[model samples]
Target: MDDRNIQYIIQEKFHTLSKSQQKVATFTLKNLQFVGVHSATNVGEKAGVSETTVIRFCYAIGLSGYAQLQREVTMFLFNEGNNSSLQNYLQSKQKLIENPRFYEKTMEKDASRILNISKNLHEEDFNRASLLLHTKKKIFIIGYGSSNLAAQWLYFTLNLLRPKVVLMKLETNEMIRSLQEIDEESVVIILSFHRYFKEPIQLASEIQDKKCEIIGITDSRIAPITKYSTITFVNEQQEMSTIDGMPALISFLNTLIVGMTAQDHDYYEKQRVKYDDFQNSFIADRWS
Candidate 1:
């Protein structure tokens, strides 16, 4: 879980916390993990505040000491915090009335998350996945919850660019039933983010016995299920105080769709022409 209490601090103490205090708060909210590792002096130095102000900031937040605050920061940064679902970041707020420092810090956090994930998207994995997507007989997807929706979206859209695909829903027994039938030619793509459903990894682990490929779309390298993934693309999983959702992972899926589509020019052109012809013939009749 991610922290839900920070926004309350931004709301209640925005006017009261001095400029230096506000910097401390914004910096902490954005990079809690970094602060957790830094000493009080280092933290204060980074945020352009005094060590006393850092300790005072911790005390202001109901924490006993800077060390206690650091522990909570660790929990939140490492996704071990006993906090509520991260829907606080999904709220809607007008930019005109928003906390500028908080919003800026939120953007910075997203950038850090995205860059960190980019750093982990090993090039060899990308090349291997591109080849797998191009050569695989079929693409089978697995995901539950939000990841399920993303899987469904990928299944529907990728068909326009590739060949056969399947999203054997999150049913474990059914997955096992289907897994037993899939040949070595088939590929599995697992879509999951925070609190990843365990069943996918279990299914993939089983499929590994048959020498099948596994791909993962997840939140971060720190994610629990990542080591099982042959190829994992980590993307920012929305960290704003008022944003609907993260679309970064979808952008990568869309990229793969385009890459596979570009592989064979004639096939792509013929499919586009056929689809356009069908659309022109059928869509206009319904509209008129």
Candidate 2:
């Protein structure tokens, strides 16, 4: 068996571990070096659990006994320091201890991933999304928590290209007002990422009930919100130690806008001139 697979196994099974198992798992993941040198009773004391719980945690993570767990940690220390899960932003300490240059490596890794996303993007998905944005009667963009700002920026960009584009605001009445405007003819765009906020899921459900078209921008193809969407854009976002991937999402959004502009040059030019006129009158005067 590949002892190197233990870290990813722990991560993938984290949510399913019992409370006591989680306690042991958390401590073990953060202190693999210590586990390699210590006995089960000593490790248990450091993790604030009993030796039996340590043994149980071992079994829970698919190890036969505490000795195997120690062997795995030893193998991890000698090799396999660059496992992908260690690069995750959520598991901060692991990344630092395993690879001190994780930040720089992550930047290069994430940039390459984003560029590949653009290359692999399906033509049909792009055309369908751009066509809908150009023709929809009203477009409502929804995102909550970390995604709220991205949604707002998208709303602003789309509003400039066409009218009746609204960002779903936080207030209860505003949300109701936005939903009231949604129907079969309307289009909704939802931006959701890892640990996706619940509000967007519920909102997607409501929009699905209206039989409106949904455009889902998320990291996974099987993301919950995709069930309600007519078009789904899966732009994978890999989190670093402290930052979530935003550049990739922005790249996708920019492409969407560019596509729309290309589809209707006359309409876009008309809106651009109007926008310039408003900006010049209201904001440009400060330059003088």
lDDT of 2: 0.78
* Deviating ranges (above 4 Å) for candidate 2: 1-107, 240-242, 284-288
> Candidate 2 clashing pairs?
89-240
- TM-scores for all predictions: 0.62, 0.64
Residue-wise lDDT of candidate 1 within 163-251, one digit each (tens)?
Answer: 68887865668776778767789888887665567777777777777777788777544354566777776664444321233545655
Which structure among the candidates has the greatest lDDT? 2
RMSD of candidate 1 to the truth, in angstroms, is 10.8
Checking candidate 1 for backbone clashes, the offending pairs are: none
Q: In model 1, where is the ten-residue run with the lowest total lDDT?
A: 236-245
RMSD of 2: 10.2
lDDT of 2 by residue, 1-288 (tens): 542245555654565778887878877766778888999998889888899999998888788999988887887666445534335445544554478777777676667867968986889989999988888899899988667767878988988889998899878999999999899889899998755777888899888889888999876554677778889887754342114457667767888989988888998999999999999988867776
